[model samples]
Target: MLNNVAAVLLDGVHPFELGVVCEVFGLDRGDEGLPVYDFAVASAEGPTLGTHAGFTVSTPYGLDRLEAADLVVVPAGSTFATRDYPPELLASLRRVVDRGARVLSVCSGVFVLGAAGLLDGRRCAVHWQHADELARQYPRAVVEPDVLYVDADPVITSAGTAAGIDACLHIVRKEQGPEVANSIARRMVVPPHRDGGQAQYIERPLPRSRCDTVGEVLVWMERHLDEEVTVEQLAARAHMSPRTFARRFQQETGTTPYRWLLRQRVLLAQRLLEATDETMEVIADRAGFGNAAALRHQFVRSVGTTPQGYRRTFRGSQAA
Candidate 1:
């Protein structure tokens, strides 16, 4: 369990994501028997600074405070694709990390981690829109495109802004176990454990049908992720022809049925990979991958890393 926390703020800090760091680690949850961190909002500049939302936050410390911190968090900011990060900030980040402190980023803050050189030759995750730019910016860093987050041992990054909450929950689960994490989630009104490596699949707008077309089909498919679910079966369940069902599913969800199912299966596979000591073959069977080879192929294709690699990376990042 970490006792110290430091958050490095950028010029255009996204208020919500930064608030996540404040709420999760910076706040005192000790009344609930959870460990409370001595947290500080850190920057290279003054304690009083500006946010992207056109307001000022009263930070109490600077980057030097991170020297004694156990975890360093970077929240979302604007101008990630083109702007250069302050060199001093990057240097201080590297220095603290070199001393063995864990580093974390949410959303576009992955850009700052990349800029700090912490992502060199490391497997990482980021918001999808910025994944290409992160890869292009740091050629050596392996970017996981669709995951909620990726933990490359001492460095961790999350997807879009809200996914930061998921990443922080993962850290809590790692340090305090599933029960404590669940308690915190109940208090926060979010999922208890959304394994760090799960995909960030936002549900698309579906047709507002007078009939239960897409809704029924979605529920049926979720209940039967393991069973062989054919398009024909879905069509039959929806009482529509196979051709029409496929057409309507795509029109509603913006993706093919098979692709969405594969993503969900991949998410289940990642959870089993992280939470269980099961072998790849067993995890493959349970997660509907048929075999370890199939699981690896799809996992590497979708997450930019093998299942074992993802597990190792995330397990190696804790108390962050």
Candidate 2:
């Protein structure tokens, strides 16, 4: 039923985010018996817009194009979080939702929706880096920081970058069917449905310490991931009492020793799955999970997907 689609743009729009919307909606797939949307790029500011990447985009379509769209997408921009949107554009967005049409936002584009008051009392997803700011800016909106996307019916919000693709395909699947979405995904060379949240992609850096007391023990732990060891043993290796070692480890690494080891083991398993053709049993043994079941359990907990699924995703048909 989502036959008409429009992407509204502003100055300083991020090209990749805009491209995601266009690629999903603008392309003609009628040759494969897929639904091809009546898609157009509308300019909110003017006919000519400057991209964040130093390129210019010119479109003949204006805000009037949105009047007939079944879905309106707001792609991310460099200054969308802080900059004010056109009053007319915001009003047009409210009208679109009022008429029962869906509106989706990619990354910081949620800020524009927030400004339009569409996010009030609605759950939304944004990039983790901007989560706090979004919550502070729109106190009424529920900001889901760790999710890849949130579908609140008329208003859908996605996290940064490739998450937008997931959201777009989700809309297609919901309206048309999995067959259509899967076919489109096949052409795009992306997973039909990715199994993970933003938590796995978030970077957690270790805090710098003036004097790293547990540095030597940390190195030893990395090299001996296959060997089972205890916190008491690691404390002894560091020449400190267990309590002091745990405290220092937390201060230096921002996480407990057990958690650090678990994460590293999962990362090692990921490498082996991606770059090697080893069997699950061998990978589990090398990563210190001891067995395939244990490896699967911990891998799913850490990576948000099964080891086999991850392997199939990364290695494709060559993962045998």
Give each prediction's root-mean-square deviation over alpha carbons: 6.1, 9.7
On lDDT, the candidate that comes out on top is: 2
Compared with the true structure, what per-residue lDDT tens digits does model 2 show for residues 78-126?
9888898899999999999999999999999999999999999999999
Q: List the residue pairs that clash in candidate 2.
A: none
Off by over 4 Å in 2: 195-320
**Per-residue alpha-carbon lDDT of candidate 1 for residues 1-320, written as tens digits (9 for 90 to 100):** 46788888867788899888888887778898877889888866577767888998776677788888888898988776678877888998898789887888999898888889899999999888888988998999999998888878689889997789988887776655555666677888876655566557645444577385676887677667777788998998898999988877876655678987887788678677677778889888887889999999999997678888877755654411
Residue pairs with colliding backbones in model 1 are none
Compute the lDDT of residue 85 as modeled in candidate 1.
Answer: 79
Off by over 4 Å in 1: 205-320
Poorest stretch of ten by lDDT in candidate 2:
195-204
